[model samples]
Target chain A: DAGITQSPRHKVTETGTPVTLRCHQTENHRYMYWYRQDPGHGLRLIHYSYGVKDTDKGEVSDGYSVSRSKTEDFLLTLESATSSQTSVYFCAIREAGAYEQYFGPGTRLTVT
Target chain B: AQTVTQSQPEMSVQEAETVTLSCTYDTSESDYYLFWYKQPPSRQMILVIRQEAYKQQNATENRFSVNFQKAAKSFSLKISDSQLGDAAMYFCAYRSYTNAGKSTFGDGTTLTVKP
Candidate 1:
């Protein structure tokens, strides 16, 4: 929970349209991550940010782009949505020098 | 690259009984961390327990305890006197000290507690 919120808790978008999910945190943690949960794949990291304007790709970052312009907000964008992109997205954060990462409620994204 | 493996896809235990969930990991780094996370129907990832590679002592949180074998690369979670609320999808995770924020997680084990 950790004072983390993801916008558009349930989203339905058409294929080929652009979609963006937002993660906002109030704890001012140093690390933020975006992950997608699938049936068989478990949870796969899509992107993460260490600081403002500093972002990096994760294992499944092929179709996802991320930006962290501010400390509290991190955005994940899909250039063109696809059926494969439909899944539950989770946002996680960790404080400086901490080992445990806390997660948000999650956003369910669907593309038809 | 590190990988976590949860061999048991699902487990069940009777109320007031005990159940152990198995977890094995492959890692080349000597200094890292291991964790157990539980996600119930709400899908909220909750931290169950954590084990550091350097610590030889096993960690215990009330009824939740961990059996950590550093040499065997095995970490198992044991829940004593199980309750219905303890039933959830448990995931084993690994985080290297070098890559602090990035965690590698296992497929997961769905636990069911019978009344």
Candidate 2:
């Protein structure tokens, strides 16, 4: 509903293989974030971007990396996928001076 | 880092009735934001309501309202006229205005609406 789109809605990859999930926003929001949702743990931040070429690590950024080369695109990559990395990844965006964030449909990733 | 807590792991409510979900947070900062996100079977994280720390008045969105006790660091969500579709996992989240946009979320409370 926030003009946010996440690519590869579902993904399956082998362990040790690299996987990348893409989050694109059409609204050109100033901030974008990636989060992973698990069973007991609600949602943990992975990485975020405040602007083009500006990125920062989140709480659960150990196994993930993010890039924001453009204003409308943010990419999250896992260099070596693992079973523990399987999760439902979400992309969220917040407008300037806004206190709330809008989330996109999530992507379910499985690492076998 | 700010932390959000939802002690109720699960709760049940009758259809057309009302239910309240409790959420507490810890933060040293004076200004921040609290949010309630609903995740249904579709797995989409929907923003149900939010409250600004600086504002004394609570925030409401249609049937969803928040009882924000700034002094107690408590933010509870009240759902009126609960429908079957309201059965979902409700998460409490906190974000610091001075920090990065990263939000800390509670484990979540699974709400079940009984007909």
Runs of candidate 2 exceeding 4 Å displacement: none
Q: Show where candidate 1 strays beyond 4 Å.
A: none
- Each model's lDDT comes to 0.92, 0.92
DockQ for every model comes to 0.70, 0.85
Looking at candidate 2 chain B, the ten consecutive residues that score lowest on lDDT are B94-103
Among all candidates shown, the one with the greatest TM-score = 1
Top model number, DockQ: 2
Clashes of 2: 0
TM-score for candidate 1 (chain B): 0.98
